[model samples]
Target chain A: MKILKQLKMTCKDTSPLISESMDGHISFGKRLRLKIHLTICKACQCYKNQLEIIKNLAKKIGSEDFSSKKNQTLRPEVKEKIKQSLNNI
Target chain B: MNDRQLDSSMWVDRYGDIMYRYTLLRVKNVDFAEEIVQNTFLAAIQAQANYAGRSAEKSWLFGILKHKIMDHFRSQKRFQSFNQSDSDDSSVDDYDDSGHWKIFPKDWGLDPEKAAENTELAHRLEECMSGLSEKFRQIFIMKEMDGIDSTQICNEFDIKPTNLWVILHRARNQLKLCLEAHWFQNKTSE
Candidate 1:
């Protein structure tokens, strides 16, 4: 019955499994079900691939290499205020 | 006073700009980001006793900064935002009643094996990320960008494992649709 349930999973059910698989491990049964669904479903496959792309770019965005070069930092006045406050302590 | 100011100013001189940029990237508000960094420095100074030998001062400062960032997310008004998202599966429309994609995602044509670095794509992705609600954005970045494990995140946020996955899924679905519409179909990257 459980195997039947896994086999009957729709894109709705399987999509989360697809996403969860990336975040961490899903059960072997769920992974098997996802594989079957993905093999048959082009959209689900696309969703999986696109997530990988998004993940790749997101890592760069979070890392210094992508963000630090934008030339943004603390304002001089703000720095002075922080320093003054720190000196008061 | 001179010794303490020297210590404080030295921290500001070295880590202030970097911490500001890091916070700004996540929070996307200059004032709020600066406030968070300022709090981080202040906290680090207070926590200096516990900090010794635990780690490098720079990492200790950044660690405190990360806590401050999470604290901002965990503030009083965050309950409303979290509750709203919990009640609504905003990506429900992305699929139909029968559980199929209402609009099939466009072929991004990226190689699944290799992630080619494209600043333009990164810039576009960052823009799309900002469109997400703050809670979703931070969790997504933590899991995907910061390499934090799902269990740790679940414990940290006090969310059910299911809720965490759902949040991540919604974020991915939304970001995908957004990038497809704004970047792929916009003819800039095409």
Candidate 2:
């Protein structure tokens, strides 16, 4: 019973660790504790899965080129002038 | 133009559009993004001699562009205040004193592969991101999108690691709630 108590973590204690774990910053002991807690706690597991989805989605959104939607670009004249400056340097 | 100069010109030709896209997403301002990209090229030109040929030219240019973006954010007094004011509203309160969620997370029904192919979802996500407070949006983008290290982000923002984690936690929670309402739940109801 004492051994089980040592591994127990409430969702409040473990939720922030979910974010920290994603960033690869959590300590190994806390990670193990979180993992053990996650195995038993379905709610935190759902939270962990959802955060992973959000992170992956954010990364995709970040890498995407929205130029086609907005049609924003450096004008040719600006590009030409920058190149000219580069040449003069 | 000499070979080195020609190389520099080609760098702009190759990286200008990519950098413009990246900066535009972060700043969400076309003119500012353009100015930053232009300045990145100028800075590259001024520091041309320092190019060690260690990293890819694209990466080196990106390093300069990232600094330029950080400078723009640092100069914005509004962003600093927004950062402070928004802390009270963080998702930290969602958890109870016992450290369990007052309201447990709802299943998101996320399909990452399908979502990746769905341009509409991508656009929706961009909208959601833009909806975030400026500082949260910037830190979230820098960490998740740009793949900047946490320690570097801490130093850049003059924030402690714990503060960074709290901000990131709130950012993720906010984004999840936003996307769940806009994308996931909307899809189900439709």
Candidate 3:
């Protein structure tokens, strides 16, 4: 019973670390514990998978995409405003 | 034609739109973004003599824009207030006392290829990002979109590395939840 309780606590504690681990390094013990918990916990497994997808998608949809020349352009008037500001400087 | 005057006039045509878009994503306000970009160029003009061509011209302008962005948030006190209110609400609700998810993660129910290819998904993401609180939005974009390093983010925000991780963790959680509800789940239903 105590082992089962500890396992549950391990699963809970390691979930956010799963997300954080993607950005940087995690300790070997924690990584081992996370792996153990993931084997037993389907929900956390799903969470880790989804977090990976989110992270990948975010990397793909970078600031360049939002600022892509074909996607969004400054209004001509705004451009004019900037040009005027520049000339006045 | 002095270097400063020539550079100032040419920058409007060359770097203006790109800087505007970059600032717009961070600031999430068109007018404010425009103003910041304008100031960035003006500051560049004033400091053009100091720009020794060590970096690319575009990078130099971006550096100035970044400082202007920080100034905008700091002067408005947006980050301080929003961090207090939003962090309080999110940090408590997402995880239970035992650090387990109160709500289990939901399957997105879409093929990864299809989801990534969809232009509409990208549009929805920008909308969802805009919905984030100012500080979270700024940090998430700086880290994920702009690809800025964590250490740089910490120095810029005057936060410790641990605080940076906590903010990033919360930001990712909020973004995941937001995209699931508005994009993935909604699209699956439709």
Candidate 4:
């Protein structure tokens, strides 16, 4: 039982998701170990919250318009010029 | 127009913004970014026969653009600005004061959902992002703002998975603390 417990903590240490503990890609044993750790660890719970915040902020930033009129103006001409230059080679 | 020029048009239409934006972020200069995009296309045209199509067409253009950015940096001796040479070795210590730390990230319990409706907080957050180091800002923009996956980002930046994770973790924590402090400071002042 003691050896099994050490093995569990070692798994948690190596796993990236032990903090935020993302789902989908983790192995069953590792996931169980992380779940056990999270049940006792307030720090890991805070880390999970932080990850959620980052993801939410990222989603908001993605919806905003980062493109400008100048960037839009350059597109067509740059495309035309690329084709023209390619054909000559 | 020549056949090569016509052939290049399809490629350009597909990848122009990607190449331009990638270059713009790396160089941080509009004219230089435009020049790099033009040169990348021109080089792609000349080397059109070499494209293997293994990667997506946009990725190919971006790969070329990356090279062009490097070449431009090399020629102008502004390579110092594009330096990620030291960034790889740098790790977050308990305290690395030489690189400013505005807020200590100790048990803030900051919740984004709570902050979501606050337009003032969003504006302040953007201001803080603008103030981050160029390396940190680019990584944050590419990974977080653009929603690129870690594997794709690793391929694009030529960094290892560990390094990529470090950048993402640090960028997230930094922004969180920054936003919390910004909001807290304003609240106290009010």
Residues B1-190 of candidate 2: C-alpha lDDT, one tens digit per residue: 3322326747777878778878888888878887888888989888888987777677778889989988887777344753564545456688878777888787766564454566676667777888887788889988998788999888777878878888898898888788778877877788
Candidates' TM-scores?
0.82, 0.79, 0.76, 0.51
Total clashing residue pairs per candidate?
A: 0, 3, 0, 9
Q: How many clashing pairs does model 2 include?
A: 3
List runs of model 1 lying over 4 Å from the truth. A1-9, A68-70, B1-8, B76-81, B84-90, B96-98, B149-152, B155-158, B187-190
| Candidate number that wins on TM-score, 1 or 3 | 1
Q: Which residue window of length 10 is worst by lDDT in model 3 chain B?
A: B81-90
Model 3 agreement with the true structure over B1-190: per-residue lDDT tens digits = 4432335667878877777777776787778988898788889888988887777777778888888987887676533643444434355565777767788877675555455565666666777777776777777877877678888877767777767777777777777788888877767777
TM-score of chain A of each: 0.73, 0.70, 0.69, 0.54
lDDT of 1: 0.78
Report chain B TM per candidate.
0.76, 0.76, 0.71, 0.48
Which pairs, if any, clash in model 3? none
lDDT of 2 at A19: 90
Candidate 2 pairs with clashing backbones = A11-B99, A12-B99, A12-B100
- Model 4, range B1-190, lDDT digits (tens) per residue? 3322334556666667756655664566778887888888887777767876666555566668767876664555433243455344332442334432223334434675764445555555666676677667766766666666778756656677666665666566567667667765667667
Q: Report the C-alpha lDDT of model 3 over A1-89, residue by residue, as the tens digit.
A: 88655545444576568867877888876677778888887777877777666665666666443443235557888789877866776
Candidate 3 global TM-score: 0.76
Worst 10 residues of 4 chain B by lDDT: B94-103
**Candidate 3 vs candidate 4, DockQ winner:** 3
